[model samples]
Target: MMAAIATLLATTTALLFGAIGSRGGKEPTRNPEELVTVPAAPSKPIRTSTVRSQPSAPIPLANLPTSREPTSPQLALIPKPNAERESLLERRKQAGDTGILPGVGIPGGIPGAISEPSAANALVSSLGAGVRKAAAGQPDKAYALEQKDTLMAQGTSIRCALQTRIITDHPGFASCVVTEPVYSFTGKHLLLPKGTKVMGQYDAEPDSGRIGVIWERAITPNGVNIDMESPGVDNLGSAGHPGHYSAHWGSRISAALWISIFSDAFKYAGAKYGPTQTSTSSGIVTQDPFESNTAETIQNIAKQAVRRAANRPATVTINQGTIVSIFVAKDVDFSQTIKAH
Candidate 1:
């Protein structure tokens, strides 16, 4: 019982303190001086460094190197020749020499200098003159041919006039001369001047009684003798007739035989039919007698026909002043070598 009473008394005392602490009250004020604020002290001024500049100065020429030559390998300058060696150069210079030095291996050496002509130069000039004279003295090819002193290639044709008259019935052979000038194919060069000669032979044809000719050789104006074959009649142009004849001698013989038989038959018929009458010499009777004997005439005609039937020789004839052409039969060379003067 005593413990309970003591607990009650403690509880009562705590309750009373709690109630007092819980009650509300007005807030209290502080001093105004304590609330006021003060500004900070001012900072010290800042400091900086300053710098100054000066103008540049010029360099002097006396301090530079004097030489302009490079350090690399190059041609060295040749020293002036000694007085003894320079005598030749001085002599050349005195002669108005303006070009490279002769016989010396230098070009454009000195101006206002003259040089004497050497013996070699004079010799060369003489040789040149001689060569020119020789060339001028050479004969002109065209002129030589025009004068007939030179002949062109063979087989060349030329128009020539006959100087001699030829008869078809001439015996064996005759020489004919060409009197007119004959030109070449182009008529620009002469083939034969005047007086070129040719020889020919003629033969007769028994059947046709025709004549033919054959040329053997010719002589040139320059005295060159050339052999030639017999030329064709057509190649002679209008100068001669073609050498040909028919071989029909039997036809002539047969015709002559028939004429003789008819004549005999006519005579026999005239003798059978006659008129009888008294013969009187009242008027001079003029009887026309045939001078030719019938048998004799027939016999002569037969003989002539027989002769014509045999082969006759061939021949050709040309009249005077007739123009003819002849061609060369072989190659001819006229070129000759010329030597140095």
Candidate 2:
């Protein structure tokens, strides 16, 4: 009886609890007005461009930045109005002038309303003056020719004779007497009269047989002195140019002296080889002999001679009355004669 009462008590407690739980377990009704529906947050979508988007519209001229204004000088480089430009072109065409259209073709196409001095023109002007000065002669120097004229032309020859003997041993100021009259191409006037002196100097080369004779000055029949720098030296007929002659004759003497010494050595050796009469116990015996010492002596002598020659100064002398031909190095204005100073 106690067990059954316990079970019955448990069942009554469970049924009481089940009824309270069922009432509490019911879902509550939602009123449409009271239901709070939260909307989703806003989102930005990603777009991939297949082709380029349209370019932005050009900014209106009025909206352009106006803070920077082109100055008058800068504006002068801009082209003028099209109608005005056409009129100017027409005028230039009528005038047959093709001068540069100042500032017309620049980026701004603004006509150079105000002309500015051209740097290029200034440069050209400076260069032209330089050319004129150069053509006249070096700066500050009197012109060689006052006008278009020549003292002598190319290939015109003048014959002159040495006034004094020119020796290769003593070089100094030497001159030549003009023996023959030197006439111009036309022969209307005498270029150099007889008795006129053509003066020059010889420069001796040390240790060299060569001597340099530079024709530098001239004296006219009236004793008028002149400089030869205006007219330069040139090659004469057959005698060759002064530069070549100076080198050739200068070295020739030295070479000839050496050649003669060697020749003498060979000659001596030949004479030694030749049969010679000898007095001995055996009567008149011809003997072949070699003299090494003699050869060495000859070489030593030659060397000593060369050394002595080196100590001697080279000289060139032109004998008096020897005709010489030379071309006038420059155009000389005989009328503008310079008196002897």
lDDT to native, each model? 0.53, 0.58
What TM-score fits each model?
Answer: 0.32, 0.33
Relative to the unseen true structure, what is the C-alpha lDDT of residue 201 in candidate 2, on a scale of 0 to 100?
71
Q: Please give, for residues 1-341, the per-residue lDDT of candidate 2 as tens digits.
A: 99999999999999999999999999999877777899999898889878978999997766666665467886545555785677677646533422444444446444434234377745665676677678788567575433223254444555666676666554577677777776654555566778878877764553443234566787887877766632223333443223212334445567547756775776687667745445455575554444455556666776776666555554433456555565555555554542112
Using TM-score, give the best candidate's number: 2
Assess the local accuracy of residue 209 in candidate 1 as a C-alpha lDDT between 0 and 100: 30
Prediction 1 TM-score vs. true = 0.32
Q: Could you tell me the lDDT of residue 208 within candidate 1? A: 38
Clashes of 2: 18
Off by over 4 Å in 2: 1-150, 184-187, 206-211, 230-306, 310-317, 338-341
> lDDT of candidate 1 vs native?
0.53
Worst 10 residues of 1 by lDDT: 332-341
For model 1, residues 1-341, the per-residue Cα lDDT tens digits are: 89999999989989987777766443557766656678999999787666666766776557767776554543222223574357556656633423334444325433222344466655665676687687779765653333233344455654455566655544566455666665544455555567878776655433233334456776876775656654424354533333334444556557657766755655554445433233436665444323334545665665665566443343344567665565554543332210110
